[model samples]
Target: MSFLKRPNDFLFRTLVIVASVSLATLSLLVIYSVVMRYVFSDAPDFVEPIALLLVIVIAMFGAALKVREGGHIGLDSLVNKLPPRGQLVATAFQHGCLIVFAIALFFGCLQMVEATMEDRIPIIGLPESLRYCVPVIASVCIAMFSLENLLALFAQKQK
Candidate 1:
């Protein structure tokens, strides 16, 4: 558990940094695109696809980070109203659901990646599958984070 803690901390920090950078970059890119389109009347063709990629990065990474922090939307008020054991059960169930969803997302993204590997995004010449790959990575992180939460929940229960 201690070993997992170190790696999980590292991963959380890394995701935070990645998501922050992606958001900042996306904002600047959009601003630049707007400026170029309205002021210069010469918006770069690559901006749209690049922005789309950045958006995926920001969204997927942000969602994973939120899960680790327990910041995502939830029925927390109802769970909190339960007795200790019931709260534990509810929390574990939530984590289990997240794990299931993440696993499904991962496999679905893998299929998309495989199916679209040969297709390229217009103006960027990058594989169309690159878009789905971000979600695959995020899904793995989501699963790991959910598992970590479940483990922590049971450990605390043992006390």
Candidate 2:
């Protein structure tokens, strides 16, 4: 219980909260948009565009959320077949690959955000900045998860 007070715990919680809230809010708005479109005469002009953008954010951040939560599915059948010591090595290798992937997400997102400045969404004519939010949010979450994973690796070594 006391371990929950540690800095790593704080960071993990923050990432989960951010990703979940954003996705939930977006989901709600999408439902509302559907209702309004069907029950009312015309769809809100911006509804589709806004919803589309938000949906991207939801999906991207939600991926990181899954990873951080350990809800991301693992191909453990093969690893489980290995001997105990082999399993440890495999797990460490997996985490290392994940860290690299996270780093790629963070940097790749930054590049996207910059390169999309001149791009625009077809319907909304909104600058691609709105679309880039997906990657930005994902990058942040992945970075956070990677940091947490690093700490966990070290903790395991210590134990």
Candidate 3:
């Protein structure tokens, strides 16, 4: 049933919501930080790190959502020129590469977080590993999306 795609749909919707909220929060935080710095001559030291975290969350989640939506940039015109089977092959290959890249990013971030667990952000006292967590989560989302697309492609082929 079409409901089989619910997980990917859920993830895409969740990422979109999270990214939208994070972007709005980031904008407000930036404005507050600027006002505090220029008007009050006092900006909270924690604001910078918090904004950075929000930025990472917004960017990565947005990117993963774009991947899920097939909104990422590509040479689609070239792919479209191929025959139907060729198009399917090209699309599958593209998503397969995405899966591999996402897997690599996941482990890379994992190692980075492990290496930085001892370090803390001076302002917020948060573990430096927190900086890398967005990438890890985004990578998981990207991998899931790509895997779903790949499976769907194969299913189409079978049909």
- TM-scores of the models, in the order given: 0.96, 0.76, 0.90
Question: What's the CA error at residue 5 for candidate 2, in Å?
Answer: 8.7
Cα lDDT tens digits for candidate 1, 1-159: 676778889989999999899889988999999999999999899998999999999999999999999887679999999998899898899999999999999999999999999999998999999999999999999999999988999888888
Output the number of the TM-score-best candidate: 1
lDDT of 2 by residue, 1-159 (tens): 234326546655766676677678778877887888898855767767777776676677677777677666566899899997787677667766776776777677678878888898876898886676667666666656655665675677678
- Tens digits of per-residue lDDT, candidate 3, 1-159, equal 255478878878888888999999999999999999999999888888899899899888987988887876667999999999899989988998898999999999999999999999987899999989889999999998888777878987889
| C-alpha local distance difference test of each model | 0.93, 0.70, 0.88
* Model 1: CA > 4 A from native: none
Candidate 2 minimal-lDDT segment of 10 residues: 1-10
The residue-level lDDT of candidate 1 at 34 comes to 96
- Judging by TM-score, tell me the better candidate of 1 and 3: 1
Each candidate structure's count of clashing pairs: 0, 0, 0
